[model samples]
Target: MSEQTFEATRAFIATASAEQVELIAAALRSRRLALRPAPADTTATSTSSLMKIARLGDSVQIARIQPQYLSGLTGTVINTRVTRVDIELDAKSTRKLARAKQTRFEVPAGATSFVIHGVHLNSLDIL
Candidate 1:
């Protein structure tokens, strides 16, 4: 490896915990998956061929995003479109949704609901 890259790797090794390193690995894998072009049928909710049927009022969990607290937060689906779902987070989970940390989308402080793409959702109580 180049000297700069070697040094960066060394620094990363020194500063990153096991879980942090795993998160980095998972990100790389997710990125790789994102680039592949082939996808399954469109009937199921999908952004990158992930097949998890979604419907309004289904309880779901968010995944694969920033502000880690939002990941795995359970919420109820308030609306559904071909590729998007609006979730009204459970009252208990609203505390974990930090408005200041939301970079890609604007959600107000103490907001209880947010829209997410279907690929990022995992059906908790799918029907």
Candidate 2:
């Protein structure tokens, strides 16, 4: 007896005319779905990456005119001998803020005064 073997059948779209092939190629080139996956080793261009870098120490401006009602509302210098400054924010004052919490900083003591301008405590750091 002879041994029998099975084979699976495969099918493909019939080849198109030269003009049709060119048209299909052009259509594929125009659509994102037809684009090949990017090469694995390819890195984003250095120039483009440089554009995304942010300079941490940049000049920012803040206005310091105090409102009439809160004339006495000012930052107090605590533990002058210590390098770090801790500003205690009252819970009642920050309860409305989504990230309502106290903020601390390690700023030079030479600064004449700290400014609290924004709704949050960290906003004072910019000053």
Candidate 3:
């Protein structure tokens, strides 16, 4: 078995006491954490858009990169312009989506396959 990202996240969050969790939840309020749905074999809805957007709701299953796509995407997309669409795990809870950050890609209208990394994801929706 491998170290599940969500499990790791939950463990990390568990370090905080119940009071802290309540405080954190209170602070967050209704902010929906961002998430990346796992990629599927489905086809893209549109083929010629500047960016194909997607949204992943809460609780989905995902696997970390299997060492092949890790090199290209081992960090956050704080810099550089992304050119491919990707599913990511960016939730504010720091456990469900691992700090709830948004990951984006620059969808190229010319390719049929793309890979992204640093994706701690569970579910996703296509835009």
- Per-residue lDDT over 31-106 for candidate 2, one digit per residue giving the tens place of the 0 to 100 score: 5432545567968533211111111232222123233222223343222111122332233222322132323433
TM-score of 1: 0.43
**Which portions of model 3 miss their true places by more than 4 Å?**
1-3, 33-127
10 residues in a row with least lDDT, candidate 1: 118-127
- lDDT values for all models: 0.60, 0.30, 0.34
Better of 1 and 2 by TM-score: 1
Q: List CA RMSD, all candidates.
A: 14.7, 24.2, 18.2
Q: What TM-score goes with each of the models?
A: 0.43, 0.17, 0.18
Clashing residue pairs in candidate 2 are none
lDDT for model 3, please: 0.34
Cα lDDT tens digits for candidate 1, 17-62: 7545544554556566667765565565555633454556777777
Better of 2 and 3 by TM-score: 3
What overall lDDT, based on C-alpha atoms, would model 1 receive against the true structure?
A: 0.60
